[model samples]
Target chain A: MSITIYVPADAAALALGADAVAAAITREAARRGMDIRLVRNGSRGMFWLEPLVEVATARGRMAYGPVAAGDVCGLFDADFAGGGVHPLLLGFTEDLSWLRQQRRLACRRIGVIDPRSLADYKAHGGGEGLRRSRSLAPAEIVSAVTASGLRGRGGAAFPTGIKWKTVLDTAASQKYIVCNADEGDSGTFSDRLLMEGDPFQLLEGMAIAGLAVGATQGYIYVRSEYPHAIEALNRAIEGARDWLGNGPGKFTIEVRKGAGSYVCGEETAMLESIEGRRGIVRAKPPLPAISGLFGQPTVINNVITFASVPDIFAQGADIYSGMGCNRSRGTLPFQLAGNIRFGGLVEVPFGLKLRDLLYDFGGGSRSGRPLRAVQVGGPLGAYLPESQFNTVLDYEAFAAIGAGLGHGGIVAFDDTVDMAKQARYAMKFCAIESCGKCTPCRIGSTRGVEVIDRIGAGQAGQIALLRELCDTMTHGSLCAMGSMTPYPVLSALNHFPEDFA
Target chain B: MENLPAIERTIEAIVAAKQSLPGALLPILHEIQDGLGYIPSESVPRIAKALNLSRAEVHGVITYYQHFRQIPPGRHVLRVCCAEACQAVGGEALAEHARLRLQGSDLTLEPVYCLGLCACGPALQIDETTLHARVTPQKFDALVDALEVDP
Candidate 1:
């Protein structure tokens, strides 16, 4: 019998030298004349233990990780293929407290299966949602999704069903499904993880969306930064051709790569970029549901938003809706990043307190210094102080405190950070990334940097000027780029006044 | 200047292949950049003509995206993450180290907002193919040394 060994091929895992570890394992297996089936699976979101090598044992998948190429020789000596005890051993992969605590509804298949294998994906309850959708009417499918209470995971938090219903109601000979995979948010990687890990699920979700909304053609606008995800999605589309386009509805999916533009993550900007224009945000009177993508009713959703659809159909809607609190239903895949220890993905119900996620799962700052501030959502999110650490992760809870759980990315910063510098960066980033169509974002951002500089130089009156500028940018700007730039700047000013002084 | 015609031919072939794609400009630009280190300024007219758009429209798009460079890059492209996540973990210092190290070298160093390695940052990419996480000044030097030795 051949022994099975798992190695993660996730971009993060690869960045951490998983390839070298896998090569060393293969070389050792070949030299020892041992039969071994090495599977390059997706990451299980436990990044600190990456290049997390797992072997299928009589018990379960025994894990060893943070492994290096040099450790492979000693591993072979210890009969690691037979689940031998090694110093790097982490016991069972599931038994890890970090993974065991959370609810992983949408991300269930991520690190568990071979991403390239359709057979493996199907075996692990992959196509059940699409299968269920195939038997239902368009309206019925829409109702199921609406009942599931799934909202857009793309920071906007718009109800997925309402968006779908509008598209379904809108009369169009040509409807389109656009998956927003252009996740340029600084602290977010859930979109990349899902697209690279279980691409078929996203495809399935898109197909179901097409069936529900009367859209036949779909486009996944992926960022150029995520080359691994693009390759995985392209491969998945090719492999799942029989199931996707051959049916009566005839759904076909195309993967489109984005240029390096942060504004392109915006739906209107994404639509413009898809049409081969500058990623300028369009004013939203004729919301995307009415006139989108070549002047047709298009269902534009984030990668995770679409990825969450399949499970809603596979399991009953109540199962998903029952988990989360308030209007925010289902699990959100929270990415713990930056200066935090045990940094990885955690999918849980919406109401998990921010402190628990920061300290309990993250284990505090990597530098062992007191964590001073945490930025949730993305670059556009607020720079939350330690005082607000007790706030829950729900959308309403965050919104109540003038913050957002945008894409569920929490970037931690230790006491070494300068909040004033961070605030300046927010303005600087806006200046660099703004689409130039809007004035408040384009000119105000540049002015913001100058104001911050003056304030930092002990120009006392500039603080009032900066606040006035933020107010103008907040109200006068066309899109979130200009409008939400104030979130970080204001939050920093409000929370950490000493940094400015 | 010697490879001007060859560059034109490459751009022509790329535009011809990808012109029919929906919102074909980005895809064509990506291919041209991938094939050639940068999208040549002269190739803009050809792309504009092929895509049936005005030269200014094409030029505007080319310049709008930071990815589409007008001039050719160095022998290697090094993108260091300068985003909030990476910045939280001394990414700014790593970027500074990269800048000082590659000042007069045959390497082009650019600031990327994020590389999705937020957890294990400070992250960087070499030539857009290889990504490195938790990169310190010392580790960055070693990686650069390896690149220099090989290239």
Candidate 2:
């Protein structure tokens, strides 16, 4: 019998030399003349143990990881191909504590199967949602999603079904389904992971959206930085083209690459970019639902939002809605990144406390220092002090505390970090990436940077000036680029004022 | 002057290839850049003419996006992730180290917001292909050394 071994080809794993490790394994296997089939799978989100090699043992798939090219020969010598003993042996992959605890819905197929394999995706419960939706009326399909209590996983927390209903009601000749795969947020990789890992899930989800909204065309606007994801998405779309729909005006998905612009992550700006223009934020008298994507009624959602559709349709809406806490229903794929020892993707029910995510799952700072702050959401999110660590990871809960569960990306900072510098960076990032659409975002951010610098240099009254500037940017700005830039700026001031000194 | 016709041909081919698609300018510009290392000022009029838009409109789009470079880059592109996630894990310091190491070298150092390797950052992408995570200053130096020796 031929032995099977698994290694992740996820970008994060590849970054840590998974490709080199895979090459080493192949070389070693060839040298030993062992009959083995090596499979390059997606990440399980346990990034700390990436290049996580698994062997199909009699008991199950045994794991080994953080594996390097140097350790390949030793593993071979220990007969690791047959699940033999080795220092890196991690027993069955699914039995690992990090993965076993959480409720993974959108990320269900992420690390499990060959991302590019259509057959593999089908075997792992892929097409059930689209197939089920094929039988239902569009309104009934919409109702299923509405009943699921599914909100936009793209940090806005707007009801997903409501958005679809508006687009459905709006009569247009050409409607579009735009997947915001421009996962430009710093601490977030769920979109990237889903795109590169289980891309079929996302494609299926988008196809389902097309079915519900009566839209025939779909476009995924991915950032240029994610070349791997872009490639994976294009491949998935091509492979799943036949599986998408059979009739005339069937769902067709096109992958559009975003030139490096963080502001384009904004829905309106994304639409503008799709139109081959400067990614300036559009004024919202007409929401994207009413007039979006070539002046057609469009449904623009994040990658995770679309990916979650298949399961919501596969399993009943009630099953997903039953999982999370009040209001914020279903599991969230919280990206645990930065400074933390065990940082990776942790998808749990919405009510998981910040404390548990930070200490329990993240295992504190990677440098073994005390963690002082964590920036929830993207660069535009607030910096929460250690005192607020007990706050629930729910939309309303986070909102009540002036923090946001934006895209559920939690980037932890150790005590050594200077909050004042972080605040400056927030301003700087805003200044650089601001679409220059409105005065408050474009000019205010530049001024805010200067004010912070003045305060840092012990100039009196600059702090108050900075606050006033943040307020203007918060309210006066046309979009979130200017509006939410103040979240990090003020949060650092309110929570860690001493860093300013 | 020598590269004028070649640049025109590149822009023309790019626009011709992608102009059929809706909102074809960004993709055309991207393809032109990929074909020719940067989007030259001379190519703007060509692109505008091809797309039936004003030169200023094409110019505005080019200037708005940071990814569309007007000038050619160095031999090796060292893109460091300067986002909040990487910054939390000593990415700022690592960026500074990268800058100093490649100060006089024929290598370009640019700041990228994020590269989706947030969990194992400080992340760095070499030449738009090879992404390195958990990159300490030492690792960055070694990477630079290897690149320098090879080039």
Candidate 3:
């Protein structure tokens, strides 16, 4: 019998040259005249030991890791090829301390199963939601979702069931269900990881959305940077597509690749990209609920939003909703990133204190420096000082602290990051990524950059100019780019005024 | 622009959606962008055609949303997360590396808001690969080494 090995295709593994390491293992095994079956799986977090490869012996999937392509020689020399045990070989990857600590609900089969394998998926709770959907009425499905307290994971805390209700109520000949796979924020790879590692789950979630809104056509608007994810998803779509043809498969969700404009993460812009045009936001009077993709009612939801729905239906809304804090019910998939230790994907029940996430789960900064400022959300998110460390992760809790639970990402800094420079960079980000559709976003952003620069340079009238810029953008701009760009700028000023000059 | 009939139809949908939107810049922008993929520079007409509003009004709304783009993005999109969580390490360095690597290529690297994976620092996304912690140029190189144009 041939030996079976699994390597994580997670970014960390790929970054650690796991691809190369796997190739090396195959090459070395072949050189020894042994047959080896290599499987590239998803990351189980435990990022510290990436390029983490699993070798199947009589025992289980033994893990050996943080291995680089260059490590092949030593690995083979150490008797690793013949199932020779090495120090790196941790037994039964599932039981690893880091992964074991997590309460993986949505990510149950993420790194374990083959992403595109429907059979593997079905065996591991794959199409159960759709199968469940087949049995329930559309209204029943929507109510189950509503009761689950599942809100949009893409930053906004909007409820998913109501979004469906809007489309379901609207009169339209054609309605589209759009899956927002554009995980554009930094530190947050939950959506991307789910798309790449457990694509079928996302597809199931999308199909559920389609059936809820009576939409025949569905679109999975994914960002362009993830070539591997695109490949994985396209393959998964094909694999799942056949399951739909016999009578009705609930809905057919099309995976449309985005060229990577940050704007495409925005749903309307995503729609724009799917239709094959420049990526820009549009005004709304007739929300996508009434008039959306193809001039029909459309329901747009984040990848996590859709992925979470399956659990709501499969496990029952109360069962899923019973986990988190009030309002923000259920578990959340958060990314523990940046200069922090113990960084990876974390799925914890809501209501956990920020301190618990940072120190207890994250284990503090990897830089070994004292914690300084933390920026939640993406570039547009605010930078909170240590004072707000106790803030809960729910939607209202963050808002109370003048912060936002925009995409559950947590970045840590150890007393060294220059907030002033960060503020200037925020405006610069807007200036570069701006669609140039509005004066406040286009011009005010550039002006904001100049003003932040002036403040950073210790110039006079800095505070006044900064305040003026914030007001101009917030009041004058049509969207969050111009409006929320001030979040970083103001938060930086409030949290780290000393950083400015 | 008309060469993309589906795109034209999507633009029409966006304009129609805007009329009944909650007047929230983001939700509206979300709808329009959803309809057309990328907001077209000439989407004013499609918006006018569908929404029965002036081109200036549609343009006004598009300009207000940060997520909307007036110009076309590249065929391949590369987004790097520059959030606080990512910045603790060398996220800025990684961002610079991406900019440099994609400089001569058709790739467009831009900073994104929070993708929700905060625990994974220095996250870089090439389409949908939400790379978690320990993102360096070498790792980025390996990830893109086998990347080819999508058919």
Model 3: docking quality category: acceptable
What are the Cα lDDT values of the candidates? 0.93, 0.91, 0.74
Residue-level lDDT of model 2, residues A48-87, one tens digit each, is: 9988999888888999987999999999889888888999
What 10-residue stretch in candidate 3 chain A is worst by lDDT?
Answer: A244-253
Residue-wise C-alpha lDDT for candidate 3, range B1-151, written one tens digit per residue:
4577776676665556555542223344555555545676666675555545577766765664444677666755667767556666777788888888877776667676544445555666654444444567897767555454443
Off by over 4 Å in 2: B1-7
Candidate 1 lDDT by residue in tens digits, A1-501 = 999999999999999999999999999999999999999999999889998999999999999998999999999898889999899999998898888999998898998999998999999999999988898999999999999899999999999999999999999999999999999998889988888889999999999999999999999999888889999999999999998888666899999998889999999999999999999999997989999998899999999999889888888898778988888888999999999988999999988899999999999999999999999999999999999999988999999999999999999999999999999999999999999998999999999999999999999789999999999999999999999999999999999999999
Each predicted model: what fraction of the native A–B Cα contacts (within 8 Å) does it retain? 0.91, 0.89, 0.48
How far in Å is the alpha carbon of A340 misplaced in model 1? 0.3
**lDDT for A187 (candidate 1):** 85
lDDT, candidate 3, A110-191, per-residue tens? 7788775789888887777787887778888888888888888888879888989999899777888888887777667787
TM-score of each: 0.99, 0.98, 0.81
User: Candidate 2 at A483: error in angstroms?
Assistant: 1.0
Better of 2 and 3 by lDDT: 2
Best by lDDT: 1
Q: Which candidate has the highest DockQ of all?
A: 1
DockQ for every model comes to 0.90, 0.88, 0.24
